[model samples]
Target: MQWAYLLGLVAAATAGHVSIPFSRQDYSASAALVKRQASKDITLEALNNLTGGGYYSEFSIGTPPQKVSFLLDTGSSDTWVNSVDADICNNQQLQATLGTCLTTFNQSNSSTYQLVSSDGFDIKYLDNTEISGDYFNDTVHLGSVSIKNQQLGLALQSVRPTGIMGLGLSANVATREKYKTIVDNLVDQGFIDRAAFSLYLNDLESDSGTVLFGAIDQKKFIGNLSVLPLRPRQLATRSHHSMSGYWALTC
Candidate 1:
């Protein structure tokens, strides 16, 4: 049986390339592609647990690779970084206090950056922190490898000085109106074989952890991983919209 190559990461993204297998099961067409096999788990980078506040990771965006730190949030579906014109970053009071929200993105600096929408991203969280920005597509480097033309948000009116890299569901949320997300591009652009990623946070008292995008570190756990089925989207969404889109185990 032929297997497909896995792409990108959690902490460290892979530097490998993805190629579709030529011969499919359907046997409808001729062998135009090679029988590509799945590559071993590729690593991207490690997550730095900042004194137990939250997990932060480094990502280089744009052509020249401007490094930035974004808090990895799974609760929200939108991934947004502060723009150079971000209100909080420019404001005197909020500027000094914006911990962990460091490094705003500049579109003009990157040669590969492309503007998709002028006002494509606007989101408000449960705490009423509203973020509004333009939609942009650029190259995002997980570690050494790159995911090309990944669409992301550039926040201009954010409360936090730092940015957010949310890995939640990409549809029917704040970002649904915008273009495809990094994760979406990760799969479509052949970064990963499928739409699955594993986050290895290690354990409590661990200062450093890693996020595996398209692969899993089998050595992290011993026993076989148990598969839990998720609740139906329609049933889960019927009660509350907020609780529905996310992955929830059904007993």
Candidate 2:
């Protein structure tokens, strides 16, 4: 079953979890401790945009790692980042007032970035946001856990300014062919055990929340984690692509 807590942080799923400490002080790693004694746990920060916009994560990409912040999207299937050539990121006057396109990926700067397809990546969101760009694989670091050679999209042209890290299913991807989602790669790469994640937004007043990938923290909720079956898309026809990797209706 899909839960609301799925949007926080992409945490580790293992017997011994790595806890990456984050805070509102300066969005720095104040403490990063891996607890082998704990059953399963990780503490990565997901800062809320104070205006009640949503949560975003501070992560790094590239060989040496370039810092970037991404909007944590739960419904989006294709994970993508803003390219240095993107209109919003390049022409700062467009949305200059908002300053949303601040972070971008310069493929040439990353020694590990490998271009897979020049024009194979394309995705559209329910909000009418469209992003089209080249597909590439690079090293992405979430706190201390590094996902090497992870496939992601580099948006050359984007309707949205900020990049997004999609946690949706592989079948929901808009690529030429279905590819493994980030969660899937985590398990295959021996970082996590399962392709499951849970979100825990501490409270409305809190500065940040947590997202646990692969393992569920039983202490957050009441009795048990409800297993909600994926209901077939009823809001639109089978031709609709926006409904992919999402629950038809909330339980």
* lDDT per model vs. reference: 0.60, 0.65
Off by over 4 Å in 1: 1-52, 96-101, 176-178, 235-239, 242-244
TM-score of each: 0.73, 0.75
Regions of model 2 farther than 4 Å from truth: 1-52, 231-244, 247-250
lDDT of 2 by residue, 86-117 (tens): 87787756554324566888888999999988
* Cα RMSDs, all models: 15.7, 11.1
Which pairs of residues have clashing backbones in candidate 2?
1-228, 5-199, 6-199, 9-211
CA lDDT of 246 in candidate 2? 57
TM-score of 2: 0.75
Best by TM-score: 2
lDDT of 1 by residue, 1-251 (tens): 11111222333334433321111011111122111111222121211111113656778889899988777766676677888888877787654443334588888899999998898888876433478988888898875568888878888887665677777656634755645666677778777755556655445545556666566655666545555555555444443665654545556
